[model samples]
Target: MTMKESERGDGGPGNGRPDTGADERPAEPAGLRGLAALLRPRVSRGQLAGGVLCLLLGFAVVAQVESTGRDTTFATARQDELVGILSDLGQRSERLRGDLRELEETRAELERDAEGETALEEARERAATYGLLAGTVPAEGPGIEMVVGDPGGGVKAINLLDALEELRDAGAEVVQVNNVRAGVDTYFLDGPGGILADGEPLTAPYRFLAIGDPHTMTTALNIPGGLVKTLQGAGASVLINPRAKVTVGAIRSP
Candidate 1:
């Protein structure tokens, strides 16, 4: 027997298994040491991927939150604006209601008066019963005359109409501008201040007469916010006189 053969048969230095067992030990990581060794290759890749995924998720959440907040802010601002507008409208409506109530009260008071018949009624009665001539009647009364001139002092017809409106509000029964009588269908044009009553040209200083109570007619001429003041401000001369007697040669109301 040789020395090598004797040592191998007795297996004096190692187990019967060969040194190949040492290679198999590294294939699987069991304990802490094994785990550390096994992690070396994959640790870097895992950390990088996880970090990126977290960042993406965080960004998405932040964007969603910002969008929701912006939408809410816009909605709130719109609501506030609408509320402010409604409040302003409500105030205006209340004021208009108060004015309407006052007008109703005034109208009711007027309706209760028995002697408030118009001058036309008296004329009609006199013509039918007393055989009085319509055109030969001499009239004396109170009234307002409105002179409308252009904003440039050019005397535009529209300004005259503005004055006519004031006269109507003042309760004039007979309004004549230049030589034209004012009627429901009376109008004015833009050219030199001239009145058009049923399409007839009438002339200036537009004299108006009222057959009603003298004091009452005067009120229309001099009342606050009346057409006289407005026309005067527009560079037009408005003269209102309380007449003792106004002669109308053949003036008749159609």
Candidate 2:
């Protein structure tokens, strides 16, 4: 039972094995095989075109169905009902426009009213200030009340005038001396029995009501060489009382 060399396998020496020669073809890659299979044209060009046409037709049909459904609501509505809805919308729009106009008018009126009220208040304040300054109206505020006692009857008109000037310089807003309102044209003269303040006779113990800052007026009079010192040097008694509220009710006649 001997086999010839040619009958033996290629490995020789009684070896038996499958041949792996260079003439055999190599196996294709899995990815390339799949690509080649896909390139083999499983679907004809006419069939692919037909499928695409079918998909497009389906989409067109769906869109048309949606459009028809949307139109069906208004189509089924009664003509009179549609007209009523439109009329209601128009009325609502007109009412909104009217409300806007009314709001604008109200805002404008409020602005005008505010401006007018502010102007009126300012005018009233100016009038009050002018009246107080002109000695046409009574004034009351924190001020000093002075009583000058002339025991020797030696206080002349000039001394009184100097005191008035000092008070005016110290920011006295309103001054009244024994029922006589001091004005811009006020004058004093020595009368028969007493000194005359603007032609009005004021005897001993002349009372002065000055409306202004009490502390300021008090300091101004008490300074050295001031009204208080001058009056005291003249042998006249000066009594200055700072009052929280002093009224100059004497008004100058027009």
Candidate 3:
């Protein structure tokens, strides 16, 4: 028979040999075939989503608890800090009140103590005092209260400053605008929602309380080129009320 036409032998090559019962073949994975029929399929990408959500929820709860712990839990470090702050403020306020009372008492005693003392009486009578005693002297006079405010809600910082300056130049002492104490470092308005003097918020309907020569202060503030005029241009009224006693207390800035 021609070599090309001959049937290929099953033995290792074209050599003629009977196939052995132990002929080698790759072994099948022992458990895969059986397990494949019984087991579920591999998890898809979306299957991990639920697990991730559970993990994230745990983290979120931790964060919320930490954030709100101060309000929710007492006896914590945060609570102690707040308590200390409040206590300090209270103590300071009380001390100020006590000092003020003592000062007033001292003043009262000084006035009454010198009534009959010959040496003191001679000194007092001899010393020419320009102003009258504050508490004993009745302050009877006409005064003005010019209210400065921003009703248009578009007033500028410079505008308010100009008004206050005009009032001051008009000889306004103890000016209070919009609940703000106009002190040395006091600000009137950087504008609405802004701070003018000493970080005090300048809001609408600013009430300027001034204690000075009432008529003079009023005239000065109400002058054509004065604060009242400037404020009126911005649609704000500068109404002055004359009062006998206008108390201006020392107001602190934040």
Q: Candidates' lDDT values, in order?
A: 0.60, 0.88, 0.65
* TM-scores for every candidate against the unseen true structure: 0.37, 0.66, 0.41
**Best candidate (score: TM-score):** 2
Residue-level lDDT for 234 in candidate 2: 86
Model 3 ranges off by over 4 Å = 1-142, 189-192
Ranking by lDDT: 2, 3, 1
How would you encode candidate 2's per-residue C-alpha lDDT over 16-103 as one tens digit per residue? 6656678988879899999998899678899999999999999999999998998888688899989998999999999999999999
Q: Cα lDDT of model 2 overall?
A: 0.88
Error of 1 at 65 (Å): 99
Model 3 — TM-score against the truth?
Answer: 0.41
55-97, model 3: which lDDT tens digit per residue?
Answer: 9999999999888987755555596788987899999999999
Off by over 4 Å in 1: 1-153, 192-195, 250-254
- Which tens-of-lDDT digit does each residue in 1-254 have in candidate 1? 88677666744446354555455655444587777887777558889999999999999999999889987864667777878878999999999999999999988878755345655677787774332122223344443333333335545566667666755565555555556555566677643444454466655444555434456666766678766666677666765566655543334453
TM-score of 2: 0.66
* lDDT (C-alpha) at residue 118 in model 3: 69
Model 2 steric clash pairs:
none
TM-score-based ranking, best first?
2, 3, 1
